[model samples]
Target chain A: MNKSSAPRQSLGELLPKLVVAPTFVVAVIFIYGFMLMNAWLSFSSSRMLPKYDWAGFIQYEKLFANDRWWVAAENLFIFGVLFIVICLLLGLFMAIFLDQKIRAEGAIRTIYLYPMALSFIVTGTAWKWILNPELGIQRLVREMGFESFTFDWLVNTDMAIYTVVIAGVWQSSGFVMALCLAGLRGVDDNIIKAAKVDGASMPLIYRKIIIPGLRPVFFSAFIILTHIAIKSFDLIIALTGGGPGFATDVPATFMYTFSFTRGQIGLGSAASMMMLMAVIAIIVPYLYSELREKNNEH
Target chain B: MNIKRVLIYSILGFAALIYLLPLVVMVITSLKDLDEIRSGTLLSMPQALNFDSWDKAWGAACTGVSCEGLKGYFWNSVLIVVPAVIISTVIGALNGYVLTKWKFRGSTLFFGMLLIGTMIPFQVVLLPMARMLGFLGLAGTTSGLIMVHIIYGLAFTTLFFRNYYISIPSELVNAARIDGAGFWMIFHRIILPLSIPIIVVSVIWQFTQIWNDFLFGVVYSSGDSQPITVALNNLVNTSTGVKEYNVDMAAAIIAALPTLFVYIVAGKYFVKGLTAGAVKG
Candidate 1:
């Protein structure tokens, strides 16, 4: 818009070459360029090889018809919703509780927030062991003289999705807590003082005043977690391998199996494109609103 | 009213316990004998504490012809991860700095592409990535894996630094430019020092991601070049004659220890790093 300054600003035209060129080149060629290649592969009759031969919609058809693909789609939805909701609730509660002027707050905060540092490779396997029917909670309860104990969700096809949800919530809720807690910190202390003057109950104050104030942070947390849910592979692969007969399968793993293990590159690419579309559909609107909100704040 | 405070503390404590329970189980199972692990409760004390499984996991578990444990791939992971972290984070920081400070035309679109790269699941891009790597003669090597990590790590690292950079006053860069400092000079001296918090965050995030990555390792590495996660996967995932529960648990713990250490040590920074963008921003 400032056309008069355009030539003057070009005085530094060569500056970006030092830093920007390397980043731009890598990002474009390796990332976007490869992505285009992937999209092309999806449309071709490739199978464990680079078959540039044309084969439109065939891969897509197979991708849609595959039971595993359908299961993965369903699993993504179930896990995504559950993971987002529970993480939000737990994160909010932790943030609010930590906001209270409590003793040992720093230490407790660290304990609540440590999980985000560890990768799912570790946490997922730990969860797998902990949720194992024979080695984990079920057996632990049985030894306590509760012989009727049976919490084998990891092995149960119908309930394996919940197992993924549990581990997911555990891993991510801490990060969400940190976000909400920071938002809580940013909340003007005056508002709380005003609430106290009005004799608002703690729960009422949190529910009405704090929660609403924290909505943007909450939304950001939700969006990030939703993306994580959609792209969840490490946890599923590590803990269950989409196992107990593909009960906990997700799109990410489906993509992997088709592309690598099963040697169905075209189908895998098609499945991935579908997953990409799903992610874009969900993310674009949420991100637009979030950015708009930021603009409004500024 | 006094009791309610106790109740709140208790609830928080209980929640923390739930979160920590699995980690406790993992450590315990690693120390237990197979018989004890088989019959023992997950939360139960080991009948006899043993280091055998740890030794076995580190040095004795077999993948094919070799019975050497995760130690073989340990160096491979390190070699791959260190460079991958440094390269990606450095590039990411530069990307962040240029995008936010420069704000050239189409900068937002460029950023949009970077973010899109992050959101697209890695597996979705695996087939083409494999082909590309194969064509480049980098497939199934440490270089290939490092390339993958850098590409994947770009989005998040850029995100971390960009959000942090935006928080800095623009006047700093302007003033530096007035002093005739070039991009690299300003970035290296001024911007990087100021970015300690976020750099720590970026390093930790990238380290854990690269360290724990299994899919990339499996697809991009072979033979002695496989990272620990791939070895760990092969060890635990492929059940043959009889599953060695103790060794498996020990191997899992071994595979996870580095990241676990990062969490326990930099736990505060980790949360701070992640929440820095959403909460602090």
Candidate 2:
């Protein structure tokens, strides 16, 4: 009986490991393994297909020197900053407004939040029509006796990136609103009452106490928005096709076009590495803080 | 006070209009005939309610060499999403079960690694994945896309189930074990039965994500196996023919309809899943 039970006991102990092994293997190979291959490809002189020859940062050199790459990098900076800032402000305002115990809060909140459920592809295509000079808002307004009115940012190279920011904010501001609302609801009611009793204005209360207390929500929103901004591909693709001539290409789109279409695999891999670095820069700090907080709780 | 209430309501109503305008335009344009779309205002109601555009967008619109609308791509999404969601969710549940209930040395470390996987940009994995898929003879196949999604999706599904199962009491598992139930038995009988809510949340979340995904669809799948998002994009951006704004809008709506329906029906669980994923992250 003891001999028979020994192997069965061992199998019992191994079952969990067996169950988890596939995910573990996938995580190792697909995630970490691919990441390392990307790093390797970035350093090699690969084009059209990945080559293993050591190239010593030639791709990085070319990427930095390339004007289109510079445009993409600059576009990312503009889109990232404006998208995060606008979404945070708009989301916070909406959250605070809704938190005023207003009637029809549920309906209004749903209206704002519904876009979050839609894909960026859909968001982009819809906004594309709306922003089109001839077929959309511009034409509508032009026919509305406002003949000189112009809002043709979609096709305007200088203004196309801002169009992306606009669509992005529309899709995500509700999410930010939801996050801030959750933070607002968690605020101590007594404190707000105390401020009210002290004859503080509502704006003053919000500025001094409420906003200050929601710092963590702000942090969380910023991190989430930053990453979204970085990985923004489909929106730009559908809305502008990074267009009026690649004026709105962010790093993600740049990577795709170069690696897949342009056959500059080495350059594309380099861009991908830069994107990965940007993500890691944001994520590592966020994870460290999160894990530290959890450890403290434990 | 009355003025304040009116001001707030008016502002909110205006904001709501702005939010609804694009969707309204999409629907209106989708209903209008091509000539009316050309002459009439974009915001105007269609002169004649036309369902032909919807029919065209679904079955007759051309993408590349195929004139079949988004129908095939839609089914491709369904095939890819259903199996991927089920398999990934089951794996996630199992991983969550073991990580929490059958805790071992370095389990937290493994969980941390998985969490890190969630944060890594998919771009990092793109080239390597394409190459890897090619090596496995799965490149440009639906199975390849499904595999890619499952691999990427495991991080999220695992995160969801792990966080949820952590809240489940361990005493139940302890009792089951003492009653001579083994690992798989306890999981199937005790844990899986208790996991319905999280499973729903996981399914809804995964379904929406995989359905909406464009990057992997465009990159991995090719020919007729392309998912709807990619096909819709191709149809919209094709640039060769006269721009069929109506067909494009209809196709966009068709591509968006599944997730939209899911959201409208089970929005509560969707919000729960979003908050659980976001707040914890």
Candidate 3:
């Protein structure tokens, strides 16, 4: 009986491992494996279809020289900086404002956050119409006797990317607000009371005490916003279609157009590698700190 | 103090209006005739309420070669979202159960690897994924889309379940093990029963994500197999004839309605999931 049961005990231990094995293997192959494959494709001389023949730095050379790629990268820079800054400031303000024991907070919070529930596709399309010169705000303002009031950023080459930023902030600031609100709620009330007892005004207390304590929230929000900004594809597609003529193109759309539509897989892969590098640059330090924190706690 | 009260309420009210403005325009435009949409400003109330665009957007709108509106793509979204959500959540729960309760060697390392999966951009995988899907003969199919979502979603679902299960007392598992409960037995009889809340959270979260996903849908699925988002984009951007703003608005609303419904109905769970996911990260 003891001998028969020995295999059963071992099998019990093995059962859990076996259950976890498929996910582990799939994650390894699909996620990590594809990442390496993308890196390889970026180096190969593949166009129209993937090829395995290695040609060092050729694709990256073309990627850097390509004007459209540069536009995409530039738009990403402008969009990323503005989107992150505006969302953070607005979100922090909203969170701080709502934290003032206001009434109807739930209803107001829901309204603000509803956009985050909608797809960027929906947000983009809605904004596309709202910013269209003839159909939307500009027309309304003109009818209201402001004939020179022109807000046609959706169609302008230089201003199209800013429109993307506006829609993005509209969609995401509420989410940032929610994050900051959670962080603010986590703060000890005693600290604020102590500051008050020391004769610090509300604004000063917030500036010195409350805001400083929300550093982790700001970091996490930055990480999330940066990820969204880099991966922005659908919004650009729906809102500007990366036009008047590819003016608002970001790397994701640039990659899609080249690799899939124009059949420049090598250059597309190179561009994607840059995106992956950007993500890794942001995420690795975050993961390192997160995991180290866990280790120290243990 | 009174002025402060007025200022706070006014600012909150303005923010709320800004957020609601687009949605209101979308709904009103969807209900207006094409002529009204063309003639009136976006802020104007419709002269006559009409559901013609909604009907057309639902049943007759052309997207590429298909003129079947968004109904087919909506169903396609449902098919992809349901399976992907269930499979990922179940796998996540199982993995979480083992990682937390069973505690095998290298489990944390495995988890850390999974966390890395969450951060990488989906673009990095598109080339290989397209090739692999073709190799597996699942390319441009709903099943391929489902597989993609599940693979990407695993990290998140796993994180949710693993974090939740960590708080469960492990002595129960020990007691079950001592009482001759085997691995599957303990999981089925003990762990899963206590997982209803996390399961709800995971399902709602995954459903919204997969439903709202446009990148994977556009990349992986083709033709009639397209999800609502891609279909909506194609419908709105086709530009073959005169552009119909009303139809476009209607289709956008249709595409957005499912996740919007989920948000309205189960908003508490939605916020909880978002905060939990963000805080844990």
Question: DockQ, per-model, please?
Answer: 0.60, 0.78, 0.84
When 2 and 3 are scored with DockQ, the better candidate is 3
Per-residue lDDT over A1-298 for candidate 1, one digit per residue giving the tens place of the 0 to 100 score: 5644667545466566446677677778877787788888888999877687788888998887888888999999999999999999898888888777878887887777766666676677778877888767888788889999899999999999999999999988887888888889898889888998999987898888988998788778877887788888888888898989989899888888888888888888888888788888887898788678789998
Model 3's CAPRI class? high
Rank order (by DockQ, best first): 3, 2, 1
Superposed by TM-score, candidate 2 places the C-alpha of residue A253 at a distance from the truth, in angstroms, of: 0.8
lDDT of 2 by residue, A144-197 (tens): 999999998998989999999999999999889988998999999999999999
User: Chain A in model 3: its TM-score?
Assistant: 0.96
Per-candidate Cα lDDT values, in order, are: 0.82, 0.91, 0.92
Please name the candidate that would achieve the greatest DockQ relative to the true structure: 3
- Residue-level lDDT of model 1, residues B120-169, one tens digit each, is 76766677777778889998889888988988888889888888899888
Better of 2 and 3 by lDDT: 3
Colliding residue pairs in candidate 1: none
* lDDT tens digits by residue: candidate 3, A259-294: 999999999999999999999898889878877988
Distance from true location, Cα of B278 in model 2, Å: 1.6
